[model samples]
Target: MNLVNMQRKHSSYLLAFFTSVALMSVGTARDLRDVTEPKIPPSCTTLKASGGDDTETIQKALDSCTKGKAVALSPGVFHSGPLNIPSGVGLVVDTGVTLKAITDPALYDLGAKTCGTVDDVGVGCKAFITMLRVTGSGLYGKGTIDGQGNVTLIGQKKSWWDLSEEALVAGTFQNVPRLIQINNSADITMYQLTLIDSPFYFVTSIETNGFTAWGLTIIAPASARNTDGIDPIGSQNVTIAHCNIRTGDDSVAIKAMTAPSRHISVLNSHFGHGNGMSIGSEVNYGASDVLVSGLTLNGSLKGAHIKSNTYRGGHVVNITYNNVCIVDVKNPIYLEMDYVHLHGNRTPEFRNIAFNNIRVLSTGIFILQGLSDSNPVVVSFNDVHITKGSRWSRHFANVTGTWEEDASGHCGYAGNE
Candidate 1:
């Protein structure tokens, strides 16, 4: 070959080698970019707050958030009244940011706007954060939400907990607002947040779908009355996972107050010093396709508790329990049909319940009860073993089901049995 032709071929080979190397480097850079990109949307807010009753500014920020951008609470204390969260908005509460709820009752319950049956108890609608019919929204940050539940309202020396306890004596729940209340929302995500000391439930969701709560730390004193951690009322396809909850009431209570709650899951959580992982205090409708798995509970009152009565008209079906470990709990598995003020004719039914792979070290276990007219039927216990030091017995009234060994235990009877 000629020298010029050979030189041209050599230049071509060098260019090809360099081009291949550049292509490989470009591919590696693309992979690194993909790895660094966030799975969730980023919080890019231009709004910054200075101080003192930043409700209007924060609400304006939230209102201005778009699909790609988010509203961020900068690292400081922000006092706010009721704030509404709309659809397609993202809120990021940064670390060291404390959102404090104002204690004035007038801003929330003004003009006689009431929550569910609040008029019967002379209370009105109120909350710290309200999300109604929101979709595709995300709230993820490491911050604190102070409900200020212990503060006394105007002209009332009693705290909210004391007021709630007194109201319970008269069978009324009034004059208290939840920390976060969302209704009919979908695709909502809340993570890595610390919600503390709410006068009512930490988060109350009704008629929501595709909601997820994860990596949440919910805490209140044991004397904080009726302070549930996460309540999903009539919500569908909701998931509560990886939460550390220590509250006064149920750590996670799935209720059926508005509609039927279906496909609810509580997984991989730690519950302490609370009512452990309950189904309902009010199952007025239906709750089905529920699954509770991989829960480690300590110092809680009850585990796998289902409370209803003859008056609450509905059924709990297709509930499954797996891999729950309980220690120092009062009653590990309690299913009762004896809620108070049950005067209605329609009886609640608990059917098709299955318990498997539960290990309990508790004071007692198995309160397996049902109503006389509508007995709890088709409950099967598989591989459930309990070691109770005090009151190691099962209190069975109208519960009729089957159990497999090593389930040799004593069962006490009620008067009808």
Candidate 2:
């Protein structure tokens, strides 16, 4: 029992401690892997190959699904009027399946309903696929949703574009229906789908929460009217990621008319030929704590724009745009409180908007004009470089904020950049 015995005992103790620690680590890893639910991929149920007025047929398929079921569409065209998607169901469109919307206005139109006004956009009765109070559901696939936006309606020589323009000019548009509508729902996911040529907004959500949309291709003609891509209204804890959008209107527009939309994040997406990511052209209620990151906006009309008329305006605060690259965009970073929709008195409250690490190429008239009564509070920027535009071409009025200078010497504030 001398020094050699004591050293041997100490070595044995160290070995025991190391072995226990390694075993504990392996056990923790196993527990982490076990916490995730066993994904069953849902039960697969295919829709029937009906030829005409597939609304009732498709409704039957959707209604026949048990909770958390997968209803798939086969490889062909299924013409449908208006349809309903049940809750706790996942819709899968196969590689060649196309759910074509019937343009026979009478088929889709239930009755004369009010269109998108101050706080009433997604509340109407006529949508291609409507899901109300549907929870824990998903509509995803590698297929297409053909809205036939270019078709000429009955008794009209021109296509939907010309008709839509006429409606916009006349200030009363009730001619088209939206592609997909999800209202007052939660825990929904939409992914990897081609939503094209809608009569109105391609995909819209209202009063919903915990929504996630990704890998979507939303495209329409530039001449097409009001075809917005991923419109999220009054939804919270939402994440839209890796979506490509080329539509006639806003690619990712955040609207809050009836309820406030908060804690929303849009990550790693591309937008073009549209009104870029926007907030509150119709923020009638309020919005807060929204984040957009890793966006590539190419050849679009506006990038990170916020447009609202005085009458249909409310608070939009604590927004952040980070690591964005805007290429060949016109009128990048525009904020107009007085959008030409017949002005009113109540000003919108905007505050704490930050753009970090933004790179712009080829833009015209970077304007941020907030109303005098409701000056936006502290719109700051960091590492924003506009390489292809002149500083004099940029316009600013009444926006009281602070921003770091881009390489082109364009600052966000009136003082030295």
Candidate 3:
């Protein structure tokens, strides 16, 4: 069989059939790059405009939509102060509309810019812009995005002390109000929305990417200082399902910078009080593969919180908290590394954490602190159930390492039946 080796084996089978048809056309253009779900537009109605006019007639029918349509908003109460969605159009709000937020907080200021320096401060300088300001890439929210102010500031009175350093050098904040600010967006989807009362940080996703907040009903007022209901900053592939967060701070916060938040998923949620399911107070630059499953904390303060801060070092490895259900939580398993004012103590590494099937009814103080020397955040506990709240008992203070209870007899970490 030597005809010049059969013409080099038929030119290597035609170069493996044109490299398998160019890798199946790049996997069909990455599955058509998802995010194409918003077509409910039948002229879209009910926009009355009366907080001193200028509603722009529902912003000219959402600027005459075309790309992936959607501009439905029917059920009353729309003073229209912010509403700016124009980039692949989408502003659906069918289930009882209600887009209020114009008590004159400078018409939901998007001028943003509280000072400058430090590399020019991006993320729109913590944008305190209210109502709704979708900056493109498929934004869709189904009804009720109300942010009427006073989400509690405890006794109020300090309007920047009636301004005057030239109105505080004119960087803005003459009133303060932040309800929905999705900056640098990419495929955002909010379903069954009911976001209420905000003066700061209600639903903010800076530097976004493929976010989905499902069945939401975030209400702030337990003294809403920082507000924080759903803040997926520096995000990527996030999905917070069936939400009902009652916040004053931290309902679902997974910040980034050091990169630690890749495909995040929080299922069937219902958090009370606040400061509950958090990942990092802003992981200097790291946070990877997170998943907080089926949560339901009734009276939370700290249930499944993993904070880090030593001048923001980084590293909070693959986290997973499955099927959680705490009643009177005070601190049902929190892991802190330092968290105060971060500087650079270095030591920030929490590897593959997992807490499966948790069910608590308590004032248990289970804190696992780790900092000096580093390594000690790899936790795994299957089927955790703690009960005994007449003051607090279950304690595991200053844990440095090794609490591996996974032989599957369904964990019962000694006592407190």
Question: Best candidate per lDDT, number?
Answer: 1
Tens-digit per-residue lDDT, 46-85, candidate 2: 7766787777777787888888887888888988878777
Candidate 2 displacement at residue 157 in angstroms: 5.1
Residues 1-417, candidate 3: write the lDDT tens digits: 422233244444454453343333233211122433333444434454354543577778777766566566666666665666676566666666677655453444346533221122223223333223344433345667666554222233332122212233565433455667776667666766677876557787766767777777888776655678887866777777777888777888887763445666777677888888888867766776676767777776887888886776578766767677776667877887777756676557776576656777554567766654435655545455566432222222212112222212222221121
| lDDT on C-alpha atoms for all candidate structures | 0.72, 0.71, 0.60
All candidates in order of TM-score, best leading: 1, 2, 3
What is candidate 1's CA lDDT for residue 85?
84
TM-score of each: 0.81, 0.81, 0.31
Clashes of each: 0, 0, 14
Clashing pairs in 1: none
Model 2 / residue 80 / CA error / Å? 1.1
Of candidates 2 and 1, the better by lDDT: 1
Instruction: Return the lDDT, model 3, position 298.
Output: 72
The whole-model C-alpha lDDT of candidate 3 against the native structure comes to 0.60
